[model samples]
Target: MYWTERILSEAETRNSGTESLSEGMRVIIGGATYTFSEGILRQERLCREEQEQTKEAFGFKWKKRDTYESPSVKRAHREWLLKRYFGGESSEIASLLHGRENFLDAGCGSGFSSLLLFGDHLASVRYLGVDISNAVDVAQQRFAEKGLPAEFLQADLTDLPFRGPVFDVIFSEGVLHHTNSTENAVSYLAGLLRRGGMFLFYVYNKKGPVREFVDDYVRDHIRSMSDQEAWDALMPLTRLGAALGRLQVEVNVPEALPFLGIPKGRIDIQRLFYWYVMKAYYRPDWTDEEMNHVNFDWYRPSNCWRQTPEDVTRWCAEVGLRIRKMDVEDAGITVVAEKV
Candidate 1:
């Protein structure tokens, strides 16, 4: 049956009043019965819980124990941005900001990225962050305590509440691919961007058939696991990544393999292993808990989608966006585009 037809049928079934659509009540939709608000609420709760767990595991500083405008806090934010962005080229992200008059941080979790990007320029830029989970609350509190000028809303990416093209820039990193439909989310975000405004985002790359299979196999089994259980289960995989990084072995390829994007040169085994065998690169600064957080991030999400460069380019073209730059790395594909 068509999707709209299925929705109508489900609506008709619900109208029969077999089950009321209450907070915990069940509703049938598209021939599938699911707890109405409860299911969504539970998912939101789980998402928030898992995020907090991972953040704690990753040793993220939640509260600002120091002074509100302490230089230490600023320093910490800078260090985080450098580490998160590959090649420590976070300046490139900042360089994309032509006009900091207004900005939107789509899916801003705990507002850390916003802090790193515009913490100093908060008084000048009208920054707004929207997230689906209760992390918005955490973000709001953080901003409030710091006396930063920013706004946050708890909303879904598929249906952003705002209207018209009012934003100068929209930044969403490691967010769209986690949604139900990355393409739809991109289109929605594009509509919110003013003409000539930039839309910067990162989406998971289609790494290859084998890596795809491994990722799917692991995620399928762990999606339903509890936070602690997922952490425990991923421990071994994280260890393997750590062990590989410790090997410190280097090899030189005789010829360049253009198809696989491998250049003829000396390469570190740990880095190569992370790009091929597994993706659990260990950082000396990260604790064991942080490593588990990395693994959990990989296996806990149910809607992780990997798209190719062609898919990203096509989507941008469909949305009337002109690609500025596209960076492909081991982590994912980062695209900076401007609405045309």
Candidate 2:
């Protein structure tokens, strides 16, 4: 049942320094050990103190819990919605793979990208999807339902479990920044790649004047709010963003942001946070009250952070990674890098 056996096997064959890893197979972090099984890494431990491995300040645990009361289905819904939302970024991901076989989806939430890869690329690509939450169970099930060849593991990316120099491509999107140790996570994931392997990760990116001000204000204020309260507070801003998008008069700025759930925009700065408005501020699909209720649920507590292109580039450089490409999601940074 336990996959630790595989850990020792991989480590004995290929030694690793850390007790764990960021994403590359065979993570060796301080006192942790990760092992690969059926393409996924089985993460069995983290020796950090309870206070350190906590969600006290964030309001929820990084490891999603599954119970009858809150079945994994909810996370499943979020994953489905999030994947479709991120579907636009698929081409960006394709460029990272650049004709590779085996891959590791470090923080693959619900295996959305994995599905996209198999559906579009159909390269007989082997994918290992890992997440810190029990939500991974949902991902596993979804993969099975599709009858695709993939691996799924419920493990923390901070303490990855695959052998090093094992992955040709690593896809970690919008998950690393949520980790308590951002730099460590980046370095850890970096070490997992094979000599020519590539890493694709996405983290929040700082943005426009108005948006940046409000985000800072939220981090200062709503970081402590119950999910509902955070949603309520940000609703007005989302509405204003929506109004801006649907203006009768045309403002031909090179980029602005997407409206509330309004489609189309990768480079357009204006369309950047449309989903944020739909989730944090407002939702055109839902009636005002329903939208607000959903918005409330969306803004709940979790660990979150933003990064700049320069900061992320530095991270790769520190680890001796070669930058190949960079793709910025409205609120995140995703890049492809190869180990030097």
Candidate 3:
């Protein structure tokens, strides 16, 4: 079915009327004419102060549409997603997503990562992308440009429009931590999954003391800056990462420093800082804009929360989700779980 009809039929409440528009469709809600243009349905969401700030921050970040869409970066993201969420095989994605009735890209931003991970399989499912920011519009445009069919909604995580147990698969990548409460976000989204449905997500991991301190230190200064200001202010740190990466140095830790969460191993000098100090994302082949994008993503947002693996496991169990797969990395935790 077309997305317009699907939206009207699946919505929890009935609307007064809907009309076909040049771009997409329009529906009347409480005497207000809201347009679902280019597959994006705009909605008003009541948001907390921090959530509002985060929404604006990401909206600004993603508007730079093509910054991070390079082939290499896309390849890296696809590889990571496949490894962490789909048992390290691209073929596994078909089995996991095929024949699913409904798929939710919760917190989808510009549909970039979703396009990277699920572009090939989107045709097999009914896809809905939701974000708290204007990124929803960008997501719609991007999907349309690719000739892919999708429905998008601009809504907050705290107040989604969908009824419970409505989706068969949900994917939220690096988004839960940016909400008002990560734990609450987890439970609420899980409640939307039907029995035996899959919930795949990635969240920031709690880092060592010094790293956490540096992250907060940078965030405190950047939080008040305008998006452009913050982006420029973070260039030095990105440069630091590049410089360190160029050094091509490695450090050997003879003894594990349990107190600092440093394991005994041969670690790259750049990784030591990136993982344990502050986030200075580095990739030699990436452009300066691409590197700055990563830094801005980490520090510009006002609500980046970090959690331990235990916290994640408990959150899943508390929400009636059984862990099917989980991958732990220095950057964050990735989990693929199913509703019990």
Predicted candidate 2 versus true structure: per-residue lDDT over 172-278, tens digit per residue: 75667767766788998888888888776777776555655555555557765654466567677556654644453333444444433234434232244443322
Off by over 4 Å in 1: 1-100, 252-265
After superposing candidate 2, which stretches have Cα over 4 Å from the reference? 1-5, 8-99, 117-123, 219-302, 328-330
Model 3 spans > 4 angstroms off:
1-39
Look at candidate 3 and give me any clashing residue pairs: none
Task: Name the best candidate (by lDDT).
Answer: 3
Candidate 3 steric clashes: 0
Model 1 over residues 1-340: C-alpha lDDT tens digits? Answer: 1212322343424434543335554434333343334112112222334334333321222232231234544565466445544346765555656464678888887777667755666556677776766566667777888888776644555554344776788888778887767898899899989998988888988774455667788877776667567768888888887777777889897898656655688888777666654566476545555666556666666668888889999999999999877887666888878899
Query: lDDT of each model, Cα atoms only?
Result: 0.65, 0.56, 0.84
Better of 1 and 2 by TM-score: 1
Cα lDDT, model 1, residue 295:
63
TM-score, structure 1 vs. true: 0.71
TM-score of each model, paired residue for residue: 0.71, 0.61, 0.92
Q: Candidate 3's error at 255, in angstroms?
A: 2.2
Q: Output the number of the TM-score-best candidate.
A: 3
lDDT of 3 by residue, 65-167 (tens): 6678888778877888878887777788888886676999999999987898887688778888888899988888888899887888787765665556888
